[model samples]
Target: SQQGEEDPQALSIQEGENATMNCSYKTSINNLQWYRQNSGRGLVHLILIRSNEREKHSGRLRVTLDTSKKSSSLLITASRAADTASYFCATPAIGGGSNYKLTFGKGTLLTVNP
Candidate 1:
């Protein structure tokens, strides 16, 4: 079943500021991942954190997982206009037999103004 559910539905910030998005999920997950999508484009993988790990960082992005709470957060530092896009959190389905698949949240729309 689908798990991740992103918070704040939408966000707007000026360039150079920081942006933070959150996700909450139901049921246990082995790992959680974050992705970004530009308008009319496919999503890009940002970062992933395993259930065993508390936090991870990659470039300007930081991800944190709290499996005990079944929640995660993503932080983007030094946000730029190019960072304006939709962010999503994904988790693998609990059971899909041989057809393993990932389920994604509705996403948070981030608008970074120049």
Candidate 2:
């Protein structure tokens, strides 16, 4: 019930463009985190703002949280070709959960063109 589903499983953009991805989840959560995964590489933590945080920014990345709606969005500004990768959102499950671990979705694939 705590699956964070990301939309537009695939996305393509030119260099210097902006990329945005939306994530929705079922049930309640403790906190949500976004991570970036390059081909054949492990996911790198981008940013993590708790449910109480409405908005957070790190460098060119912006994250928004809406607990009431059980949704979130990520925006990457001035994207470069190197930004191409898969992005996923994760949430820690509560209520009948195990150690309150994080569960992630399939993720959205972004392809940035040079």
Candidate 3:
């Protein structure tokens, strides 16, 4: 099975607040990544954490990966209305043919009120 399955389906938060999402996977992965896509915009890479890593931070984004539990979490701090978008977790599945395949979850739609 592919890795990274985000939950909550959707979220609503006020501007300047925080938003958090969780993800789980069934198989081992080399690294887990998060991405965001605003309305009519292309997907942008948010952050990535290696399998050996436990936590990582980039700007207001924080990511936590637990390999043993096979889960990950993404936390966005001081979110703004501009942050309103769909967030998805992706994991590069290992041993897949050409290895360029990326499995993405359905994603969690976050609505930030201004």
- Order the candidate numbers by lDDT, best to worst: 1, 2, 3
Which numbered prediction scores highest in lDDT against the true structure? 1
> Taking the tens digit of each residue's C-alpha lDDT, what string does model 3 give over 1-114?
556678899999999999999999988888999999998899999998999899999999999999999999999999989899999999876555765568899899999999
> Could you tell me which residue pairs clash in candidate 1?
none
lDDT of 1 by residue, 35-96 (tens): 99999999999898999999999999999999989999999999999999999999987565
Better of 1 and 3 by lDDT: 1
Off by over 4 Å in 3: 94-100
Q: How badly does each model clash, as a count of residue pairs?
A: 0, 0, 0
By TM-score, who's the top model here?
1
| Tens digits of per-residue lDDT for model 2, 50-88 | 877899999999999999999999999999988999999
Kindly give the stretch of ten consecutive residues in candidate 1 with the minimal lDDT sum: 92-101
Residue 66 in candidate 1 has what lDDT? 94
Estimate the TM-score of every prediction: 0.94, 0.93, 0.91
- True-structure RMSD for candidate 2: 1.7
Runs off by more than 4 Å, candidate 1: none
| Model 1 TM-score on a 0 to 1 scale | 0.94
